[model samples]
Target: MFPQSTQSPPTSLQVHPVPFLANTQDADELGAGSVEVPSWQIPDLVVECPKRPGARIHKGTSLILPEAGGDLLACIVRSLPVLLQIRPRWILGYSMAVDGVSLRTMYRQLEHSGPCVMIVEDSSNCIFGAFLSEGLRPVSQCYGTHECFVFRTPRLAGAWRTEVYGRSVAPTSPSQIEGASVPKPESEGASPPAGFSGQKAKYFEALRKAQAPSSSASVFCNHMGIVVGTDGPALFIDQDLLRGASWPSVGFGSPSLCTAGTDFVVRNIEARQNRFGIGAPNANERPVK
Candidate 1:
C-alpha cells in the first residue's frame, strides 16, 4: 500500500519563478563554432568555468550532470517555462553517491522552498528528470504548478531528441481552445452537414483531445516517496531511492521516462537548485519564511 501524509495540503497553488533561462549573449558566445551547438548544449550562463587546455566538454562547474549524458539535463532546462529561460548558478542539493541512498537524506538536503531539477539515470542508460516547482519533501496533498514538466532524452544513436510533457492549462474561454464548431442540428434526416471530413475531421478531433483538461495532481509526496502524476503516475521513486516505475500519465501526459518498460533500477540520481541571490539560502540552509 502507498503510504499517505498526515500534513494538510496547501489551500492554494504556490507559484515560483524557476531559474533556467540562458542569457542571449552567453548563448551566442557559446554557439560560436564551425558547427552549430545543439539547443541541449547551451552552456550555463551564470558560471564562468575556466577553459582547460583541451577540454571538449562544455558545462558549468559543480554541475552534477555527467559529460556523456548531460544532454538530458540540457533538454529539461530548455523545456522550462519562458520566464525561467535564464540559467542561474546551480548548487548541488542531493546525490545518491555523496548523500547515501535514503529518501530522508534527500528531503533533509533539499529542505529549502525553492525550485529544483531532479535527474534520474536508470540502469539502461536512459536519462530523464522533472523540473520541480519546489524542493522535494513529504506533503499531504498534491502540489506544483503547470510550470512543472517531465522530460526524457531518447537513447537512440545518431538521434538527438528530447520529449517533454507538461500539464495542460485549462482555457478560460471556448475560443481559447481551438476545435471545429459543431454542426447545427440537421432537418430530421436531411443530408448531414458537410462539416470537417477525412483528414480534416481527424485533425480537429485530435486537437480537441489535446486541449482536454488534465489532472491537477501534478505531484504527490508522502512517506512512501514521490509520485509525479495522480492518474497512473508518470514516475514513481520509492522511499529507498533504489527502484522506480514510469508510464504515461494524465497529469503531464508523459510517456515512460525509460525505454525499458515500466520498472527500472535506479543507477544514480541528483537534485540541483538554481541559486537566486547572494542572500539566498544554500541547500543546507532552510529559507526563512
Candidate 2:
C-alpha cells in the first residue's frame, strides 16, 4: 500500500515558466550564426478544469485546449490508474507545443526538488510521457541508471499503456539542477563547469552536439520524451505509482530498468508558483488569491 502523508498536500504549487520566447542576445553570444529570434510572444499556456467551468487550473499555467475536449479527456481519465500510482501534489507547467529548450528550462527551474510528469507527442501525434521520479539531472549524476514510469495512449488506441524506464539516476542534491532555466547562460557557448565532467559532461556534450532536439542524450529523454511534440506539450507531477509492489530495484541504477503493475486514481491539480518575466503574465495576474 502507498504510505499516507501525515501532512495535507499544499494548496498552492509553483508552475515553472515555459521558455518558448527566443533569446537572440544569448544566441549571438554563443555565435549562433543567423538564428532568427522571434520578436513576438506566444500565448501563455494554461491548464483548466472542465468539471469546474472557467476555473483556472493554476494561475500562470499554460493554455488549455478547448478543442482537445473528448478523446484527450478520455485518455486522461483512463490514465487515472496510472496517475494514482504517483500522487503529484502540485501542477508545474503544461504546454501544447514544447521544444527541448523549453523542457530544459523548466527542469533548471525545478532544481531537482521533486518528481514530475511530462506528456509528449510525436510527428504522428502519438501521446506519451514518463513519471520522472528524481526530477531532471545529468546522466553522470545518475546512479547506475535512473528509473521512471512511462505511459502511452496511441492516437488510435482507447486505453493507455503503462511501462517503466530505468535509464536515469536520482539527484544527489537540490543544487545539482542545471541552470538551463535561463536561456542566456546556457546558450553562452561555454563548456560544462568544473567538477561536472566524465560520463555526465560527455552525455551533456552529446546533447549540445545534437543541437537540442525534443529528446536529447540526457535521462530527460526517458522521462521527457524521444519523440518531439507536434503541439506544445503538457507537464506536471503525479503520485508515486509503486505502492503495494516492492520498489522494482534498489540503488539508483542497480537493476537498471524494472517494471511494476499498472493501476490508477483521481488527480488533483494545485497552484504552485507563477514565473515572472517578459512572456509571463503581468504582475497583477500573479499570486492568485
Candidate 3:
C-alpha cells in the first residue's frame, strides 16, 4: 500500500501538526520533497458492537456517523461526547515498540502542532491513522483487526505525552460508514495524487520487502499505512492493500506505531457498534481552504 497524504485542506477531521508532514532536513531534489507534511485527519467512527474472542471485529457491526456536521472538525468533534459517555474501560499505557525513528524526534515533529496522522503499519499492510497531537477532533481513526499498541501521543518528540487507553477498533470496510444505507458513489478524493509520478516496479519491490516482517515496518508506515482505514482507503495508497502480496524482505509490524505492553493490561472490551450521526467518510471530499 502506497501511503498518501491529503493535500487539500482537511474535511471532517482536522489535519493537526498543522504543517502536515514537514521535512526538517534538506537534500538533493530527489530527497528534498520526499517528506510529506500530514494535514487531514483521516476520518473514521466508533461503533458499539459485540467483541469476539480473537482478532475478529466486524461481525454484527452497526453503522455510525454523526449528522448535522457543518465543517470538517465538527464531524469529528461530534463523537467525543458519545465515546466518553460509554467509557468502556479504555486501553491504557499503549506502547508502540516497533523500531523506527526515535520517539524524541517524533515528539518534536508533533509538539505545538495541529492534528497529526500516525501511520503505524508498514508498507505491505493497510496504513492506519492515529492522531498524536494536541488538537481536538470528535472522531478518531480506530483499529479494526490488528494486534498492536496505538496510543494517543499528541506531542511527539516533546518532553511529555498524553496517552489514551482502549481496545483497537477492528478493520472495517469503507462501505460500513453510514450503516446499511446505500453507500456513497465514491469517497472524498475523486482523483489520485496530483502529478502521480512514481515507479510501479520499485513500488512493488517496496511492497515485497514490506510484508516480509523482517523488513522495516517504517517503510510501510511511511509508504501506505496512513490510508488503510478501509479497502478504498488502502486503494488510495501506492501498494495493493488487498492482494496481501509478500514484500521481498520480511516486514516488521507498523513502524511508526510503537507497541508496548510487556506490562500488558488486558481489557475485556464488549463489542458494541457505535451509530455515529455522521454520514459516509468523504474519502474523496476534502476542504479546499
Winner by lDDT between candidate 3 and candidate 2? 2
> Please, what are the lDDT tens digits per residue for candidate 2 over residues 90-195?
2334332221124344434445434545554333334445445545443432221123334343343333222222233433432322322111123466643333
lDDT for residue 140 in candidate 2, whole number 0-100: 31
Collision pairs in model 1: 21-85, 21-86, 21-87, 22-85, 22-86
What is the TM-score of candidate 2? 0.31
Poorly placed runs, candidate 1 (over 4 Å): 1-64, 68-70, 169-214, 277-289
Q: Candidate 2, after superposition: displacement of residue 6 in Å?
A: 34
Backbone clash count, each prediction separately: 5, 37, 92
lDDT of 1 at 83: 46
Candidate 1 vs candidate 2: the TM-score winner is 1
Best by lDDT: 1
Which candidate number has the best TM-score?
Answer: 1
Measured with C-alpha atoms, the lDDT of residue 253 in candidate 3 is 17
Q: Candidate 1 — worst ten consecutive residues by lDDT sum?
A: 46-55
The residue ranges of model 3 lying beyond 4 angstroms of the native Cα positions read 1-70, 84-194, 200-220, 223-226, 230-289
What is the model-wide C-alpha lDDT for candidate 1?
Answer: 0.54
